[model samples]
Target: MGDPAAQALCAALRDRDWRAARDVLVTVTDPDDQAFCMYAAGRVPDVQEWIGEWADAEPRSTLPLLVRGTHAVHWAWQARGSASASRTREEQFREFHRRLTFAENLLDEVAGRDADDTTARAFLVTAARGRQVGRDEAHRRFAEVVARHPWHRLAHAQMLQYRCAKWFGSDEEMFDFARTAAAKAPAASGLAHLVASAHLEIWLRLRSGEDNRYLQQAEVRAEVRAAADHSVRHPQHGRYAGWPTPHNMFAMAFAVGGDHAAAAEQFRTIGDQVTELPWAYAGNPVRVFRKWRGKVTDSVA
Candidate 1:
């Protein structure tokens, strides 16, 4: 979503040019953009090798710590892989916990020094999930972020993941949270994507035909249309670095739900900018994207 700034930062981090990365990161002023940027950059490989230099270089600044801590969360998950707990090995789980703990410490340091560090606070919500820190702890970390920046798209997204049935909450809990948050966010804010995300999450959990059936339900499809109007489809929707993600999510939601007309509209808006999520939950991201897109377009044609 916030891939542009993250790509620049990733390039700098890859080159081990902390100064260049810092220069690029400082240009982004919005706290949620800052959080989104760091979260995306966290996927860069071997950042742990040289990020400490940035930390040492700017002992007082939380940016380095933010980068390092966010990277650790990604690093932790990489160690764990995307498999279910039963599919994951004991060693992988151990390393996942260790890296998550390391990330938590660094994030905690940032939160300590900068109470307003939403980037740090947001990642802690992620860390809570990795560590399986239970609902209360996850909520506390989420509370920390919204208390500072209410309707923070980044924080809300992470918190929504934490509350998902796959994590700690039930399907009911997840839907309630998504509906409430989407309603609470400004009409133009990308936060309404949470509804799409929740729908996509439930779809992922259901098996095969059941998944498609759930999405195609009249009430479910209706809810998504309302959310789309409230956010991405809204005339006032602000196109930002993360704009494509919601479009992609809704596109998949519609195509799978048999609303080819709606799906075709979103695909036109999306073009080639496919996100890894909702699609990845199905099959090869690009393949899945094109498959559904072709089907929807043909149906509409």
Candidate 2:
């Protein structure tokens, strides 16, 4: 039977009242629901506590614990300046390893299965492992998954495009690829953002280099504006919202088009709302721009 407390918590969350959700979730007797609720409420400390309680009560339920534990670890890392953060980080890492071992055992139990569940599990494992190791390897594994199941092609393509954007030097080639990918996967807002980002990057590069291609600048700005507008209207499903990429892109386009005051206002808006770790973008354009902004400004000056 479903826990009544959990049901209440779900109802509260649906109403967007996190405080009520947290209170109800903490009262729930079910470990799974407790862990999920704590995560939804962004209550990292409570999540860690629930993970420990759940792990001891049911050792086999490791995957959910691990997912919650990862969130705890991420939060703990952000709390690095706190006195207890180091110990919390170490504890979370140990739990992560335990969860990984359990996941491996679970996979072994269903080895050779051709079921969709197995494929999904494999895909998640690959993506998680990729984050832990190298982006290139992660993209390679994602590509394999898509090849086996074309239904996942759009997601894999977005990941690959992110990898290319972060590590590759050839802007024209990357932009071409992004344009094609975006056209092929019209439903994927992430790919659409990448397409817009590629154009923005080209514009940034040209402006820094004093390339007087004003016609090209106008075209790139229009393309980026359209993509950003589209992404704002149709964000990718299951992706984190409120990213400042589109805002930053619009600001950049305005700045390049001699709208300094508008650009400054946009930048201020982004700077005000940009949290330290709101979401993870493997090949985030805003991060890249921030890292190189000083150098670009100096060169242009």
Candidate 3:
């Protein structure tokens, strides 16, 4: 959610001003922010009831259903069982499927009412992927969303996850999508981070220290550099709704590729901000970040 929107929504909710909150929500133009607000609002029963009442008042509005679906899928993904209980995993998967089914149905309803609802289409991609829907169905839903909003960061990221080998997609397929998506995105749009995301996925799949060798490959090095220059070094580069993570991904890639100077620049840009992703794959995110940040910072010193 946009910081301003989040703040306004929080204040309205605190003041029990449902009408004001609804007004604030209806004006949110960013699909990702809209979905996030719905997810956050879904946490409160009273807020949900207010949302349901709003939906009743405006049956044609897809916002309520879209929020509900996004919230359900977000909740379902967190249903992972405890590590010690094997049966719990099975139970969790069953419950996950049930919740996903409900979410998918809600999204489908929204689609039926408004085929052009980009947010709904994006959630459909997520819902289908989570339900283990076939690659073809997953791709179809993703295509529907990206076809309408080519620069959608969240949609692209979700599709990247869908195409990951761990999710029944091969590395070749994942890289193909990542490259194509990156190429289609404008340089300043920061969508080129899709390639960094793909590289991270490929690295995580390798055993032990092999990822270092993989990152050193000629082709990988070339692609990573091109993406970095376009999205991270471009004069037009600026902050987006999703910033720092992309810069952090590039920083990790450059560090692994042994370009300490380039890596150091990225770290300087990132400053104290850090994301668990890509780094988390290595170990404790904070420790991993410190290791790389130290590696480059020390070189300059």
Alpha-carbon local distance difference test for all models: 0.88, 0.45, 0.75
lDDT of 1: 0.88
Q: Over 4 Å off in model 1, which ranges?
A: 1-3
Tens digits of lDDT, candidate 2, 1-301: 1235535654654454445644564455332233333333333334434444444654554333443433443343344323343555665655555554444444333332333222333334333432354656555545545565443433443353444544432665676766765566544333455665565455444554463254136675567556544554354522322235445545555455554444455555566443222112213644644643433344345
| TM-score, cand. 2 vs. native | 0.43
**Once superposed on the true structure, which residue ranges of model 2 sit more than 4 Å away at CA?**
1-50, 58-63, 72-136, 144-162, 165-177, 187-190, 199-216, 233-301
Q: After superposition, how far is residue 249 of candidate 1 from its true place, in Å?
A: 0.9
Error of 3 at 26 (Å): 2.5
lDDT of 2 at 296: 35
Tens-digit lDDT track of model 3 for 61-166? 7766766666667666666433334555687888878878877888888888886677778877777666788878888888888777777767788888888887
Local accuracy of candidate 1 as per-residue lDDT tens digits, 1-301: 5467878988898899999999998898788778778877887889998889988988999889889998999999999998888999999999999999999999999999986678889889888888889788889999999999898887888888888888888889888999998889887777787888999898888898999999999998998889999988888886776778889989998899988888899999998999998899988999999999999988989
Please estimate how well model 3 matches the true structure, expressed as its whole-model Cα lDDT.
0.75
- Residue 91 of candidate 2: its Cα lDDT? 59
Candidate 3 residue 165 Cα shift, in angstroms, is 1.4
lDDT of 2: 0.45
